[model samples]
Target chain A: MNLAAHLVMLPVLLPLVAAALMLPLGERRRPLKVMLNLASTLALVAVAVALAMRAGTGAVDVYRLGDWPAPFAIVLVADRLAALMLLATSVLAFCSLLFSLARWHRVGVHFHPLFQFLLMGLNGAFLTGDLFNLFVFFEVLLVASYGLALHGSGSRRVQAGMHYIAVNLAASLLFLLGVSLIYGVAGTLNMADLALRIPAIAPADRPLLEAGAALLGTAFLTKAAAWPLGFWLEDTYAAASAPVAALFAIMSKLGVYAIARVWLLLFGVAAGPSAGLGADWLLAAGIATLVFGMLGVLAAQEMARLAANSVLVSSGLLIAMIAVGNAEVIGAAFYYLVVSTFALGAFFLLVELADRGRSAAADILAVTREAFGEDEDEADDGEVGVAIPATMALLGLAFLACALLLAGLPPLAGFIGKFMLLDALFAALTPAAGLAPAVAWLLLALLLLSSFATLIAMSRAGLNRFWAPLEPRVPRVRIIEMVPVALLLAACAVLTVAAGPALDYAGAAARALIAPQDYVEGVLPPPATPEVAP
Target chain B: MELVLTIAIGVLTGSGIWLLLRPRTFQVIIGLSLLSYAVNLFIFAMGRLAVDVAPVLEDGTGNSDPLPQALVLTAIVIGFATTALFLVVLLANRGFSGTDHVDGREPPP
Candidate 1:
């Protein structure tokens, strides 16, 4: 009845209602659609901020839909970590939506409604206290994403959309099977109830439950773009339109977030044999993903693919740290998740605009045309600039900021994040742990080497685009496009300046997540937890 | 009855995975639909099969576990929407590239 009680559902409901309101409206009413989207996203941001502040106070806000009791009816929870994820999503969604207003909103039908629905789905996933709804929300977001990915009518976009759809459809199947397996075994889908039930599960059922969990992890890893299952990532992200690509950056982290929640809550120390069952797999997969991502980054011919590959590296680092199941490491990974997603999203938007003025055969076309005494190149509306244009200058600065953030350079949030993570892991790594020390060193080396590789790839890209423009032409960028990129980069700057509070928030959120009792108790009312034995 | 359902699911999944590895777009779509069927049935059976029983819960009367059924219904609708979208994308790509291959090339066929 109170505002805080209602606040738990506002984030999910706001977007759903707005999207529904926009659905019947014709695309010809573009201005109205844009206004509705911007207003809703801004409102969502405000609501998320309030929820996040409330969460920071260490109180878990749970709202049962229809006021039904937990473990039976659906509940939406806003714990510290969930609120943080919601806040990050709304922030990125706001910026990306603003950037799309430059022109992409009109490129396809139902863009506004789909965007809203995507937001609704994302918010619901983060807030839901049950696994069934998580699957439901994953489908919702993926369907919207499929629409967004193929928004512009291009053969390339459609090609990539097919692969994206196929892979996700398969992943969704896996998700369903996993959820069903868990439900069949545990007879419940509510996460808190599962936590209560897991400890008493029969030893005969343990392997089945673990199998279900592994299948679920596979689904998340596919979405997260882990090592072997991440083959579709670079091409799909590269093929997506700019703003859509930017928003898709957070899509990978959704996987990691789900893993963070489930691993800590349902399978933490309370789950007996299931405690930390798949932690080793997460570590191995994480390192392999990082290594493969490093190769992808270096081998990328286009800057767009490089941006995509770097996303894999970010996921790899987060997944590896998250696997260690340390409070401090999870906290550092949380901070790194926010920073790297921001940087990658900004870089995707920039690459789209910056790539406009260049032709496919840039160097060959320039030299051959000049040798043939043909000025056909200059006729393409781009003028060689004597002085750098403001657009290029702004783009260069944003790219530099993105590069620094991506490479974990100092005086930025990325550096601070990597430093925090290493500091935490260094304390855990020892020769006595046998395989862990080698993994620790490998992780540390990969972190630094990936950063170095990013520097090289990004500088090569930077030089190609800005520094030594082979054909220096001012890229036609509007104010709307530039504002979002600058705003996102400014956020990275603010994160750097506000690292103390940010780190404290992340630390508290991670502590809450690592200590599962707080979350389990928060969602469920005080009652007898029935113990079952086979 | 459980044995029959389990074998059916296994056969569907094995064949579905086999077809998923093919490079043709239509074949891949078929594989996906097949997999979706398997998963939907799997979700349905999560409720523990109740033949000739009312699905709705009534006072003291036996009913099937309806949650998995609800989830499967949602998955079915979503699966339909995606199948249509994939078909559209595939057609558009075929028109543009003059190929049915998933990668948009005929591969020397």
Candidate 2:
């Protein structure tokens, strides 16, 4: 009943209420709606930070709705992992909303409300202790994203939006089927309770449970943008407006977060036969996704598509590391997740600005030149003497920072994260439940190869866009739009400077995730004595 | 009852997936609807089929499980909303692309 207990619900409630309030205000009061949206997001950040600090002290905060007791009632648990994800979500939401203030919010009807609802769903998914609740939250977020994806309503946007909707609707059905299957087998939908019951489940029902879990994993992987399941990602993201794409960069991570949480908590070392049920398959899928994403990055001509591919690369790395099932490696993966997501968001915003400086024919011309083996320097010889404007220079620097981050280059958080991740992967070389030495070496090489590929592709695109422009036109960059990019990049810089503490926090979260006894106990307390009516 | 339910789910899913792969937006939307219906029925059957029994417990011996019913209700509501949204988007897509093909263009004759 105290304030800290209620804080667990605020992240979900604040957005829901704000979105409801904004819906009734109508389109005429755009400025007021923007202010309300900004205020709500900023407040969410504050709450998330506070929860992170509280969770850092190694406490699990649980809030039961309507004063209902544990397993039967829906509960929200804010442990280190949930709090960390909430913090990341709020930071990205705040930045994306700020960027939208430039122009995107006015692009279509109900933009502000949809944005808030998306946040609500994301926070709910991160915090919910019940599997069924997770499905509902997934639906909420997907619906909002469907709206936001088609906000500008160009032909390309509408086409991509239709595909996105169809794919996700199917995924939602799979989610329901999986949840029901698990419920039928385990007779409970609460995750913590299921974790307790899974170990003692009848052997005859094991296959059914595993099948259900596989279905569930498929649903999450689709949303997470795993290879073959995520062909819709690039088109949908590339076609979306800048702010929406920036916001979506975090949405992909939501799947990884769920996988790490559920897989580690429910199928960990405690489950006798199911301890490592699908680990190898997860590892295989992750590697394939990583390779697919590398090719995508190299082949992409548009800047937005390049950013989208980088998201896939990051997701692949995280998914593979999570499959390693070592607490330490998972910790480093969390660091990588946070840094890469921020960088991707900033990069998406930067893409719009960078592409704005070029003429409409620039992309086609570049392709034609490449196809014909024409010298690009000779084509722009007439405009060679034009000086780069200050705005262009700033964008170039931010672009350079993003390139470094995406490719895992040094002197930024990306390098530190990748280094820590590699170090942890090598350090965790136990024969059982850890990476083999050869596999570790292979992962190292693969990581390096992917990073190298990203570097090459990014430099190629950078040169084609920034240096080989047919004309040096300065985009009318708004201060509001520019600051969000700056802020997100600054966050990456801060992460680099504070790598020691950040990794420690991530390590704690990973440990808490691997051994969720506190989480389970926190949610399902010893039955409280019933009050006698006097 | 169980056999009938299982066959229905199987047929619906098979047809839904087939329609899902069709070329037109309208077919895809209908496919999605059929898939959702199959999933809803599957979830409802998870509680185990019972005949003429109260969902809520009166004496608790012959009562059907209430939780799956509740879950199915929520799923149906969400599925309805999404199907409506998909139809709207389908119309908009047709209007914008001037074609009903999922790819926004017709195939060669």
Candidate 3:
């Protein structure tokens, strides 16, 4: 076996081993835990980058556990789509861990190990080429997230964590049912093999397969936080500690990635009538989700809640794009995914530090003043301490950058991502068989409306927090905390500056996703000649 | 035998769903446990229930598919772990909020 074939497993293995190593170390060994986690995260990032470069060349790498063959054994495949997700996740993880190191890690026991375990689960979910393993990984990540969500042990965190746990547990049950149905119908848990077997399935079994697929879609949508199924998301994410919330921004996208990969690969244009069967419902639910999120963003009383709503909007757009089933939209959606997730992740990290020094009364005061009209009393509370202009200015600037990214304003990657998506929508209309012009126009309008809503909400919140400046005690944000936020925002800046190559990579990934022939081949190669000469 | 399994799964899932809809956190956790049991059994039945047969292939006639059994085992273990974790979180939540209401408040008592 090629040594590089082993690289396919590194993303999952690196985090798992590091987390295991950290488990036995006492909480007193904080420095060692941080160092190990940082190293593990950084190494995973390097591996993901390498994998992305390799996948860009259109090669799919597959690793078989214990040298087992694909169909009957565990397989992990790294295609362009998987590699891209891994890269994005590790980048977010590295920043989140760095930010947590500032003070949040000390508030809770086992924060570091749980974070690493979450990464392991994420990487495993991204890489595993089988359905059963996907369930295992989903549970792994959820369990880790449950621990992290309750890290601070506040009423709100625990309450929200309980809701998050309960909802996901239900989804897990649905996941099992879905998996069992698929297995019963196809007798295979390997995704690629199932894809091959699905079309040949007896017509009588088609309904069961469809039911299973629909149930599976429900599970993913619940995680993706689509409306009706996503009531748990905004509050749960908002209540999490800053770094944990930041880490969770990417967690939501795991569902987006899974849906796109599985729906396209198994029930793609290749599946005949089922080819695009779910597209319309996806579009409907996505739009509803977007509208619901916009309302939440507008109504959110706190910055954390607003950020959580924006995460919903981001996922809604990606889900809508996936439902479009066009390579063009998928490409733009992939780009959008990277930019928005980073922006939202950064915003989540920034929320705690930004809110720390401000009086909760002042926050309400800021809101009411805006509602009633800016008046002299808006600056009611006189300062008792010297305000740090430089730190306040730095946070304001960071907030502005995140706002621009979230609201799809000019010159940032968010704008570029939205532009690409709009461009794709319009470009699709040029072709006769593309999404109908009216539907395209409607989607275009909806996207614009969501962005506009985000801008309005963010503008009010940003001004209220930074500009109002009344009753402000300068938040004693640490250099460690500030550094991670800056790094995350800088990463977004890099995405904006590097949009050309980024778009190309996303395009390649989208194309590969739309046409997963190579992926299927990599996962399920013709079984090697019966080695034992049976 | 298959009909019996079907009815068992139906009862478990129906009861689970009913419990899941309740506003109490403890009930929801129990709902999840019951639902997982239903799912585990469903996964087991997917391989086609068999009597007096080995899971592993021993002769030309073959045996029940063991893959579903294996999958169900893993699922059961995971379900156990999550239930324990959920119970911990619920305890913490009740400690903080002073109620087991799913919304974290008492019901006008």
Candidate 4:
């Protein structure tokens, strides 16, 4: 009934409506396409701001569709964590949209429409209250991504896109299988209903539930680019356009978010042996992913490929933190998600700036000159252009933020997040817990090492481009591209400046996730009978 | 009986993985499809292999687990769509790259 409640639905609906409207607008009408894209993204930002403001008041806003009671009907719920993620996503979406504006004409048919649809799916995924609906939203997003990933029809993009699509589709099937198993055991589709129903199920049925949970987790983990299942991410991210690549970076995190949400809600309270096994399994998998991803990032050569690999490492660390299930780690994970999203988003934009021209000779010369300052004659004769000085300045700042953030350096959001997660991991360590301590220590070491590796790789790439010599002439920095990079850089600055409130909010969000009885009660009324017929 | 079926599905999954690792795009597709069939059956079996009982509430007696059934239905539809999408991508890849290799590239000189 309140304005905040009304704002909850707009993030998803605005994009859905925009996508529909853009379908009728011919692709050749470039101005109209740009207008629609900007308008919709701006509207999402407004809605995200409102949601954040409302969340600050200390209560989640739940909207049930068709005004039906929670268990029987669909619901859209927004807690502080959901609100914060939506805000981060909107920031990335806005920047990517601005970056794509100038190139809209060149991107060919349905680019704008697919973009809008992708946002619709993202917003829906963040907002949906039912497990089944999450799958639908994921499908919606992936279908759109398939188009965006292969937009240019180049062999590399097409090949990478096929692998991406294949792996994702398999994961989706696994996800559905998991859901069916859960439904069979719990008899409810609504998350709120399932939360209450799940804990009450018999012990004999618990293994099925655990298996279902693991299957579901596997599906999401694959999407999150967790190790062993994430072979497709590096190639896919490397091949896509910068704007699309930036969007893809945020999209992959959706899976991590889902896993965190589901685990805390369902298994966080499961008693006895089940809890021990569930927690241990998650911790093991999370640590393995962290180590594998970090090794990959350290070994990567291509700039785009390195950034892509870094995403896996960061997500893996977050998952490991989530496995600890301490409130502090949850808070840290939330903050880390925001910082990583912005940093990676900016990195993709920077990669676009460097690779704008198609000539290999120009690229090599530009890199050479940028790495070492030289007079025009001394610069590579093949060098055709250079990055604008102002753009280079922004790129420099972007790289610095990325290094500090991803490396978990002091005074940045990433540092604070990592510190909190490590503190939680330390507290969780015990002699009785046996392997957990070893795992925790390994995770901590791998996280630190990975962050350092990301720092070095990015610095090398950044140094080669921004700090090196002047080519005879530099490629002009396009205004459209600069807008996204500037906005993301601004976001990182805000994160650094407002670390206290952000961490506090994240901590509160984490607590809310750990004990979601309120969410359950808010969505579903107390059962009519203490026990329902099985 | 159910255990045997589960083992059979596991074998199917194993074979699918082997094929998926092969270099050809067509083999990869076939591998994925095989894996999907195995996975779907495995998922359905997790509901504990109910027979002669529908999940729908009936005659005030017993109903099989409704949740897994609902989940499997959606999974089936989504799986079908994904398979179709993969097939289309395969066709497009062959057309664009003039090869059906999974990597769509010639081995290095």
Q: Please report the candidate that would top lDDT against the real structure.
A: 2
> How well docked is model 2, in DockQ terms?
0.91
How big is the RMSD of model 2? 6.4
Tens-digit lDDT track of model 4 for A1-534: 576557778988888888898898775575787788889988888888889878867767888778786777788888888888889988999898877664422444578888988988898898889998998999989999998987655567788999898789778877876886787677676887777777678889888878888889899888888777888999998878778899888887898899888878777754334553467666767777778777777777667787788788877887777887777767878888888888888878777666544254245334434433435334423232333566556656766777777778887767877777777667667664343567778877877778787778777766766677334234456666676787887787788788889889988889888888767666765663254335
Q: Second chain only: TM-score per model?
A: 0.91, 0.95, 0.95, 0.86
Candidate 3 global TM-score: 0.94
Residues B1-109 of candidate 2 have per-residue lDDT tens digits of 8899999999999999999999999899888889988998999998989999998778756799999999999999999999999999999889877999999999999
C-alpha local distance difference test of each model: 0.85, 0.88, 0.87, 0.77
Instruction: State the lDDT of candidate 3 residue by residue for A1-534, as single tens digits.
Output: 676879999998898999999999998797899999999999999999999999889999988898877877899999988999999999999998888776567666899999999999999999999999999999999999999987766677788888899999998888888989999988888888877777777788989999999999999999899998999998889878789999999988999998998899889877755676577888888888888998999999889899999998998889988888788889989999989989998999888888877676235334434433454332422221233358888999999999999999998999999999999898888866468777788889989999999999999998888998666667866677788888888988999999999899899899888887788878776553232122
Candidate 4: how large is its RMSD?
5.9
In the range A1-534, model 2's lDDT, one tens digit per residue, is 477679989999999999999999988898899989999999999999999999999999998998788878999999998998999999988998988776556657899999999999999999999999999999999999999998866677788999899989988888888899999988889888888888888899999999998899899889998888899999999988889999999999999999998888889888778887899888887888999999999999888899999999999989988988889899999999999999999999999888866664245334334433445346543332333348877888999999999999999999999998878877876576447787777778889999999999999988877777666677767677788899999999999999999999999999988888888889887452122101
Where model 4 places Cα greater than 4 Å from the true spot, the runs are A1-4, A270-273, A357-389, A422-439, A469-473, A527-534, B1-22, B34-73, B106-109
Per-residue error (Å), model 1, residue A395: 1.5
lDDT string for model 4 (B1-109, tens) is: 7878978898999998898888888888888888888877776776677778888899977768665566667667877777788898999889868888777776776
Q: Please report the TM-score between candidate 1 and the true structure.
A: 0.93
Models 1 onward score TM values of: 0.93, 0.94, 0.94, 0.87
